[model samples]
Target: MGIRTKLKRNRTQKKGMPPGSLVYIGDEQTEEVTVSAIAFDSHGMEEFEDVSIDKIKTLIDSDQVAWINVNGVHNVQLVDQISKKLGLHPLTTEDILNTDHRPKIDFFEDHLLSIVKMLDLSAESTDLDIEQVSFILMENTVVTFQEKRGDLFDPVRLQLQESKGRIRKSGADFLYYSLLDVIFDQYLIIMDEMDDRIAELEGMIMEDPDNHSLQDINQYKNTILQLKKTVWPVREVVNKLINRKVPYIKEDISFYLQDIHDHIVQANDMVETSRGQLYGLLDVYYSSLSMKMNEIMKVLTIVSTIFIPLTFIAGIYGMNFTNMPELSWDWSYPAVWIVMIIITGLMLVYFKRKNWF
Candidate 1:
């Protein structure tokens, strides 16, 4: 899912680059940025592919609703130009370039900016993958940037194109909410995947505890911890948005943000639940080891009990030959064998009655 961290500042660009240059926030070998402009209103929708910054500028003035989606963050100049055209703050642009930002909301004089993480589970390995997505909401337009070319926003795009919901009639803030909702939905999917894995590990531990299962549980526990680190901050960010009266955010959209807040709470709850399950699994593993030790001890104790009487008879016979009468008896060897068998049998019976096995 194109997981990325904060990019190093490109100090080398100082040779000719402007002071507020848009420094790419990720891997430099990224593909060219792909821009798609979707202009929609109550009446209809129009989509423009591979649109240039000039075209975007022209569309920004249109009364129809517009969404500009940029697929890559590698072209600093283009991003800088867009920021200038939209009157976005330089700090906001810098945050956009700093990919390590936690989920947050910033209220600018003319717009609202949101930073969020998108999660995906690796298909080959059950690893949780994440990417950073930044949203800039203006009067009638919403601009979104991603660290990579692929995303989970296809469903939202389809909805907008089909005019399937209130998205078409709503302002850019609603559109922002829709995008956030999709990202949160992806979070839920990730949580479900983790939950399924936790359940599977539980079954495996219960059936037979082993080192492999312990490692698997620990790996998943670490993944859950990482997810919690990303999501818990998101809850606080959303809470801040919900509590404050932001100018760009519409009052009607507060309820939607509240819903997102509730989802964050649920995500936090799932993390806690997964943590408890991991602890339980560790306890079960230890208990299994203890039980195995007890079984081995039981067998050794039984063998010692059976040999005790036999050892006593042998000790008596080994005394000075002149004093040992049984050693000279004609049937002495057979009598010793019989006595040993009787003692072993009685011990076995006692053990069976006591249900030690």
Candidate 2:
């Protein structure tokens, strides 16, 4: 299913149903679920794949930190079993399936659930593609759920692979910070993409604003609106997490979270500025089209104005009055021609003086 269809389905499925219904309201994917686990401490690391839920639990029961990433959450049964095993709230499981959620953080007694929207431009069509990513932070476990596998977290994984950073030494809270850092870092990429698109539109507007410019502006405006829906609330999520004052989340990671918050604010500002640019572009597009129409109308009006008196002069001569003296005179035709030429010349001079052209 398409993203728009997923959105409609989310709304439709909720109707006539009780609140907190667990429905997988998103794009249907037949992709097999892939679970990758990595347990690492300062000493070393253990990474594996296809680990069962019970095995993950056994791994979590150990002293080392376990990072189990579950890619493809469309399998409702698997998600339910995993959530049940992790003691996740039913609403949290619903949120995991329902991927239209804004960036938010919900706290529980034993664990913390943080939900965020991941953004990407579709390579095939240049359309914005959005996905929801949920993170569960427990004592020794950090479980990440993605609707589909994405390389956005590759850098974090690479850090683990190279043993180049403190990730190997970090606890579950630090892992949470690292994963969130990766997620919010994507906003920078998204903002840059928006900037490039806005610049392209500006060039088009300045060079050749046409009917399509309005259409493109409207499309971009809608894109910005959708982006604002994701980026702005992220600021709240960042701020709340930064000031959460929870025991599970470490104070030393506060600086890193603060940096993420700053980046989120920057992303929000860019969205607002870009939205303003879009509105301004819309106005400019209308003004450009109006000027174009005015130019055409001006030329037509000038032609009609020049013909009005000429029509009247021809009409006067066209009259078939029986007693008209000029009709019988030999020079009457030439004389009428001279009079019309003079009238036309005077009218041209008047138009020139008024700068009607």
Candidate 3:
């Protein structure tokens, strides 16, 4: 379904409900919710393909840092169950279920909640694939909730598996930073794609500006607007994280979050640049239309001006008066033909000199 229709239906479903109500406000899905976890510390790492509530509680209470990933959030009962077990706030659960929530950070007493939009450009086209991803960070555990199964976090997972860099030795906060970093990296990729698309549109506009170009420009404008909306708030979220807004985030993790902050700022700049270019392209398209119109009008005016004198000459000679002198001359027809030819040639030369066509 289209986003607008889904939003309208989402509102209708939640109209009379109280705040913090858990309502699944996204596309309809019947896939069962699946939970997977990876727990690691300096000693060793463990993977859980299917984790239960007891397993989660055990990992959270133990010394090892745990990362629990939930694939689907459409199951309200499953979400509430996990949230209650993890001591997540009611509003956090509500936001998780409401996939339309903006990218933001919510601080609670026990855990910190972060909601971010994950976007990817489809391989087949420039259209974006977007989903809401929510994170709940606690002392030694980070829980992630997604609308569906696939995501861009595979790189982060690979790092954890290979014991690469400082991820294995760091706390849950560092892992959280790694995930956010992955999201921002995708943003950079998207920026590149946007640049390529703008260049393509620019070339099309310059070569052959048509109604299709206008329509494509408009569609891309909306796409870039959505990108801006998703990216702009993420910068604020990263800033808040860097400013020590969340207690769970440690001092060392702040430095890494700064990198994400820089990346997001760069993404924001790219978004703004794309927006300006799209506006300029729109102006070019309009100017092209106007120039075409002016060419047509100029040609019609020149043709009419040349025909005026020829028509007047013909009218004068074809008068019904019997005293017309040209009618009695034997060479009148040839003389008139030569005069008309000379007038046509002179008019053509004059127009050529004026560069009217």
Candidate 4:
């Protein structure tokens, strides 16, 4: 669905309803909600795929770091049950189901909540894909919810399997930080792709600017706009993670979170730079178009200027006056032809000297 339409629908659904009520506000894609769990420590990791809600609830404990991933939030009952089991506040679950929320960080007594937009490029086309990902970081467990099954978290899972980096030895808050790192990495990926496309567009428009070029410029401009809107809130979320001084997060992870915040700032800078370049592209396209039009108009005006005096000469000879001396002479036709040629040549020379073409 279009962004505006989806937002409008979500707002309409919440009207007159009690605050914190469970209402799925995103596109519903699954026949059944899917839940999965993973528990890991410094030693090893174990995964439970498509596990039942009851099983997932049991997986949350103090022994190891547990990552509970809920793929679909359309099932309100399932989400409510999970929230109740996890001791999450009503507003927390409410935000999880409401996928239209802006990127935000909410800290409660027991858990911290983070909401952010994850971006992806569709493999089939240039279309951009945006998904709302929510995270709840507790003492020994982390709960995540997505609009659908596919996500950018696979790399983190691979790291967990291979025991790469410090992730194998961290707590739930560290795991949360790692996941946010991956999300910001995806933003960089998107930024690189867009930068490449913009460079290609610059070359194309420079070589030949036309309607098609203008349309492509507009398309990239819109994509940059989407990037700007999506990334603006992320700075707030990351800044909160660093400055809010949540008690559960270890101080060591602050450096890591700061790096993520810097990456987010870099991504935002790229977006702003791309936006300015796109605006310059529009100016270039207009200048090229105007140049082409002036060339055409110059040629037409020169042709008309050459024809004016020739037409006047012809008009004088065609008159029916009885005292017309030139019409009776045998050399009149050749003389008139020579005069017209002279006028045409003179005008051509003048146009060339004026550099009208």
Task: For each candidate in the order shown, give its overall lDDT on alpha carbons.
Answer: 0.81, 0.84, 0.89, 0.87
> Judged by lDDT relative to the true structure, which candidate is superior, 2 or 3?
3
Q: Candidate 3 lDDT, tens digit per residue, 116-150?
A: 99999866665888899999999899999999999
> What is the descending lDDT order?
3, 4, 2, 1
Span of 10 residues, lowest total lDDT, candidate 4: 53-62
Model 3 — which ten-residue stretch has the worst lDDT? 244-253
Alpha-carbon deviation at 13 in model 2, angstroms: 5.4
Per-model TM values vs. the true structure: 0.84, 0.83, 0.89, 0.90
Candidate 2 residue 147 Cα shift, in angstroms, is: 0.9
lDDT of 2 by residue, 1-357 (tens): 466787797679788887657778777788898888999888888888898989878877899999999998888889999999898878889888877777788988779888898888764434788888898999899999998987588888888888877888778988888888887788888778878888888888877788787888888788889889988888888888888888778889898889999989988898889999988888877777788788789879977887888899889889998998889999999998888789888878988899977
Model 4 stretches astray by more than 4 angstroms: 1-3, 122-126, 202-217, 320-335
Best by the TM-score measure: 4
User: How high a TM-score does candidate 2 get?
Assistant: 0.83
The per-residue C-alpha lDDT of model 2 at residue 57 equals 81
lDDT (10s digit) by residue, model 4, range 1-357 = 565687678779889999897788876465667888889999999998887767766677548889999888888898899988888889999999988788898988888889999899755445788899999998889999988878899999999999998898999888999889988999999888888888888888777788899888888888888888899889988998898776779899899999999999999999998899999989888887888788788878888888889999888887879998887899989999998998898888877898875
